[model samples]
Target: MGKRFVLEEYLAHSTSNVMNGITIQQRCNDKGNEAIMTYVDHVIQGFRKDGFLYILLTVAPWCRFFPSVRNVYKNIQEGIAKGNALFDSLIDQREKELDTNRPNGFIDSFLVEHKKNSPSFEKKEQLRIFLKDLLAAGTETSSSTLRWILVYLIKEPKVQQKVHDEIDRVIGREGLARLDADVPYVRAVIQEAYRVQTLGPLGVPRQTTTDTTLFGYHIPKKHTNFKQLMACAQRSKTLAQPRKV
Candidate 1:
């Protein structure tokens, strides 16, 4: 189900940098790599803990929280600071490279929008929030999904063989320059993995603005949480049926 967690770490670092120009060291024989991995580990731990604390913080943020929760919050704030620093560095670097033909990442895109839109301070704050989300969500979802995919692949050898055969037929042994969108079976396997073990087991929370009825069970406008998606998916009628595989 895993590859020693380094794959997840590398993916997280690389994607986060792609999004915000943060420079994380690659898995190399260097002290910088160690520091990069340590920072990423902190950020990842914060992501894991934030989900549990979000419910409590959303409802009663003023209440005394656990020391561990405080630590997680601090770790996330530190990560945010690192991201902000990277954003500033990218802005300066981009300004100097205005005439050069370099590829733009997410931060570059944001910089262009900042000039065109003249975003407000609040908008800048929101952008920072999105940067954090990009880093955390990218890490969590990809890693979690891959873990589930690995489990399924190991459990179903025929399925793995089919995937191999398909890859060979479509992209060949040399590997793809980029994955084709027409690959149905590969996409299906990922979709199925998401259904079986959703990364965000708890669905996104929302507040009711007015009284409403949902499946004939709700009649109030008060705040409430939705049923966990993973639980519902597992209990779904379609999933209940036995499969030939």
Candidate 2:
């Protein structure tokens, strides 16, 4: 999760800009068109909405049939399609200009692996989905985590003052925080915030492919996360490359 990191770097390194002509991006940011929501704001709202609907789909089976819920579901589906399309355009642009010999960034790295015919990178759809997953999910989670971090910092003025002092000492009061700065106390505060505000206590939801025993405990087949994974896989026409449990 790069937070503001990737977008900041992407603009700097990219010779050929990403499809900056995106209508949705423009419309979202345009003052006359609608309320101001930057691209990150849109991603966060979209993720939050879809997550709520997923919870409904998981627990409230009857709710999916309701007209309002169905309408929201349709909108979410459309939003996802639009997002994937944006990523598809980005991938297409990069595939043409990316230097395979000097692989750069996430897309370039994946494209290089793809050139080698790795099973995980078999389809361009895989690359597209990977981009969407990394960019969208990373933006949402990192933004949410930062929100938690700010909340915690506000509650502890001494800790906040220490972070301020560290920043002043390391980068100067006038200097901006760069990614490379070694601020142990700042890092520790972030880690503590992560511990205290545990998002997803069970971690990402996992589902058993088949009825299985984990440490003599029976886990049923076909759970919610597996269903979601299958839906995404179906869209990508590629199986997930799970590197670790």
Candidate 3:
């Protein structure tokens, strides 16, 4: 995300000579509109290029999940930037603690499990590969999704206000809203926003693992490729129906 912003800054700074036939000093204002747009475009492009590659490979079989992951990352980034100091501080503290207590994280967890199951395998080397996968799989998508959510909330004041109202009603002023708090409406809003504004429109692609039959149709393994169309699914009437799980 930071990389993207930097790219946008470069582009804006390079092309800020004319605005409505008047020359404006591109560098004169610290917060120029052109600068801001450049920064944003840079960030977006950077994410689309580098971030998308790893996500594509790691979750290739489930391409549909990429958009969701990207949105999560975007939202997290926005949340941190918006001065969610508590969340920022907590995440930083957790990283520092983990560095000392368990540097491996999810990769380490996977390695331990695999080692227990397959004693003959080389654990350390396998752990390195797993760590690569973990980092690629874990970071950007979550942050992107978060940032995207923040962007939507900022754009839609009514939705944001409704969410705030729900939060206040459920948690009260005495405490902050926890994940477990009763805020179904807030959750719904988040889901609806994602549905309305898909961060990853082109989802993962899938290849059949084996011959399969579905609805009287036969799909041969290695011959069938499937791409999950999220936009189509989100618009389905069946999904619109409200029901208890």
- The most accurate candidate by lDDT is 1
Q: Candidate 1: deviation at residue 132, Å? A: 1.4
Instruction: For candidate 2, write residues 1-245 as lDDT tens digits.
Output: 64543343232112112222221222232344222223345656665667777556546567878987898777666767777766676677678888889765667777777778768534677776665555555545565666677777878888999998998899996787777898999998887666556554334556668987778967788754423333332333342432100
TM-score of each: 0.69, 0.66, 0.48
Any idea what lDDT model 3 has? 0.50
- Model 3 stretches with alpha carbons more than 4 Å out: 1-46, 49-104, 119-134, 169-178, 234-245
What is the lDDT, from 0 to 100, of the residue 28 in candidate 3? 17
- In order, how many clashes per candidate? 0, 0, 30
RMSD of each: 5.1, 11.5, 15.0
Q: Record all residue pairs in model 2 with backbone atoms less than 3 Å apart, i.e. clashing.
A: none
Question: How well does candidate 2 match the true structure in TM-score terms?
Answer: 0.66
Off by over 4 Å in 2: 1-40, 47-51, 58-63, 118-121, 171-181, 224-245
RMSD of 2: 11.5
CA lDDT, every prediction? 0.60, 0.59, 0.50
